[model samples]
Target: MVFVESELGLHSELESVNAVKILIAGGFGVGKTTLVTTISEIAPLRTEEQLSALSASVDDLTGVESKTTTTVALDFGRITLSSELVLYLFGTPGQDRFWFMWKELSVGALGAVVLIDTRRLEECFSAVDYFESRHIPFIIGVNCFDGADVYDEDEIRAALDLSEQVEIRYCDVRDRESAKQILISLMEYLVAGANSGV
Candidate 1:
């Protein structure tokens, strides 16, 4: 199913199956939107509704006081990994109240990329715990922020108390290459786990 995509407008080469829905989820202000848009080949479809004053008062801003708007429902995007594999990224809303809706969006997902903001590490705990409880395979990518102290991988693992089974690494959401690497890493982890009988 190998083929090349070129030219300005568009073209579809006849090919075999090569697409899956992969979820991008995390807590509020964790850079889900940035990561999805960075790696998507087409312009990312974002359902970004403006934040209202009343809505702002209820949403948690513990460490992300600077964040103005929140993801209301879901954000959508797409990325082509190769001629044989393409990714449809469904970005979940980060707030806890959206938990009920998370399951629907997560259905049939191959895996998830949980982005963590180093500045708000605590916010990630619930998301991690949720995935662990569901036995859903996932990988964590820490989003490095400006002026933040870099924490070693082991240090992060220790602080999060993540089991040795989970995969964790650092990435910059704004960097397209870095974001792609995270997706590849997660896919590799899932393949290895499947091969190892997980």
Candidate 2:
């Protein structure tokens, strides 16, 4: 429950607020969890587990060889966008073996942020295809790593074979402000699509 103070100096309880569902999706080790943790107002729920020997055959560790843990199910978080509006973030597990869960997580999502690591751009192709085929509004967030090569937005769009209508931006998932901006961009894009009847 939340309380809002009016101009009359009286507080009214807000028993129900508008909630928008947003999905954070990407390839393995693309920083989906980091983005959720950075912007969530509360303690984020993470279903992470250590990389086990059993997963060695199924999980690809190309650019993320240093990663020791992975999200097995999903990552959940929330952010209060305004007094009356809140955003619920659901992060899909990156491993292909867990991709069956994406459909369940995306049931009511309004939009999605497809995080991409420049070093492993090919890894996110599946996510892009998934959202596009479902006709879901999404924005591509190119996560800038410490030593990853930088590419212009146009180059990224071309590489992804994305249409001009799609939005793409570079971001640092570890930075709260950058992550927030990515979410805001997704919201703006959604609004634009709605207004244009696209």
Question: Residue 108 in model 1: shift from native, Å?
Answer: 0.3
lDDT of each: 0.81, 0.90
- List of clashing residue pairs for candidate 1: none
As for candidate 2, its clashing pairs are none
Task: List, residue by residue over 122-162, the lDDT tens digit for candidate 1.
Answer: 87888888788888899998999887789988989998898
Judge candidate 1 against the unseen true structure and give its global Cα lDDT, from 0 to 1.
0.81
Taking every candidate in turn, the Cα RMSD to the unseen true structure, in Å, is 3.0, 3.8
Point out the worst 10-residue segment of candidate 1 by lDDT. 1-10
Model 1: what TM-score?
0.90
| Model 2 / residue 124 / CA error / Å | 0.5
